[model samples]
Target: MSGSPALFDAHLHLRDARILPFHARYVKDALDVGVTACIDCATRPEEWAMEVSSSLAATTAYGLHPWYASVSVPNWLERLECVLASDPNAPVGEIGLDGIRRVHDGGTAQRAVLFAQLDLAARLGRPVILHGARVWPLLLRLLEPWADRICAWQLHGINFSHELLALPFFKRANAWFSVGGGLLKPAARLLPELLPHLPLNRLLVETDSPDRFPIGGDPLVLGQHQLLYNQPGNLRCILRAAATLRALPVDELAEQTAQNARDFLAAR
Candidate 1:
């Protein structure tokens, strides 16, 4: 193994069947590029089994994503607890409220599920992975009661304003912000601006691969002509963009974020 700290992907959905065929390739690419750790977060029931079975060489978190807050069956919470209990290292997450995607009473269901997971995380003293889309204000408010209870939190694919970073929860709850390929876009407002403000120790990075496929983001697809998905290897682009915004050397940022990710998992 290399002496330098390994690169870390703070969040992604590697267990998704869409990327199953590329598993070996993804692992090789991640290793070749020095990315040694990742948190593969599962959103709902379908991914739970895959998330458990996959030998992806990464930590995993299972939770009901906000999009499925209303749809996920009542038994999910019990199942999630069972999974988390099975792996001492598994954390609770990818759980939070969404404002943009409208479902029947989505906001209400979102809050209910979020609080349940938060309660579970607190009881278990496990770290949490949170997702917020346009619902920052409410999410922050909801987090207040559980802030002291959470062991640690990673705001995945975070794109919030700098002003929001000043909130006491960031400090009190021990939060880390994850930046992904979204930062590569020139039009992205929050990430580029927030990069400089992130405490080096609290800064984390991810590809959110197979999702946020930005311009020039990676994978040397040989036969296929069309762009279909993303790989964890594309994290190079995200790290480069973040390094540029933070005015830090690539290696330095990589090491810092890797250490941060380890600490995040260790917090559990």
Candidate 2:
């Protein structure tokens, strides 16, 4: 990997308990394979500190995921603010509406949490890492007001239609889209169509480690067996998939997306 361009895993969750024990292994593999950076996204309050601390070679983001919206913990917002304030440059994110899963109060609580984080991100002039599954339309609508205020934003693992690009907020400068390993699957829905429509400069790649594992391979096994665990090193596979879609050399795509990540993170 000496001559290969270093890669970036635009989104992942290093603080996940299942992955924690293997954290050092993941980092070693990522670095060994030329993965230079990543964004470790925290989904809740308890994981925030560890998320930041564990990202020794990557950027860190802390946010209240929509699934945890109904949590009745005291001073969560205040604590979140304290963490964001601790590192003004770190992103605010992994926050957005999720319509697919059942949550308390039919997503009302989720909306409240999402909106509050959006407001906070806007107020702090921080870039955001957003997650939208079955709620892209609502997410776009909710982000309308901060279209101008927010410094930058990345929609992680977005598999939406071309219509998303037409949204006012998406049209704004500094909007980004991260392509994950999911696109590598033969049955990928909107990615094949969506990738061709997106500007390469605004595109990024991520493994969403320990989550959206690519189709048809055991990431944890290389021999005859299979182990279905995603890791930061898997970013190489995603970069290859994206390179095929963009019709560029893998090294070229890696360089472009690396620069894109730098620019996106600098938005804060």
By lDDT, who's the top model here? 2
Candidate 2 differs from the real structure by a C-alpha RMSD in angstroms, to one decimal, of: 2.2
- Total residue pair clashes for candidate 2: 0
lDDT of 2 by residue, 1-268 (tens): 7988888889988888876766676677778788878888888888886633443467889999887889887888999999999977789989988877887587889888888888888888899898998788777877788787888989888888887788888666478889998788888878888998998889999888888778743375434745577887788878878888789999999999999999999876
Deviation from native of the Cα of residue 227 in model 1, angstroms: 3.7
Q: Tens digits of per-residue lDDT for model 1 on 62-102?
A: 88899888784868989999888888888887899887787
* Lowest-sum lDDT 10-residue window in model 1: 219-228
Question: Candidate 1, which segments miss by more than 4 Å at Cα?
Answer: 1-5, 51-56, 219-222
C-alpha lDDT score of every prediction, in listed order: 0.81, 0.83
- TM-score attained by model 2: 0.93
**Structure candidate 2, residue pairs in collision:** none
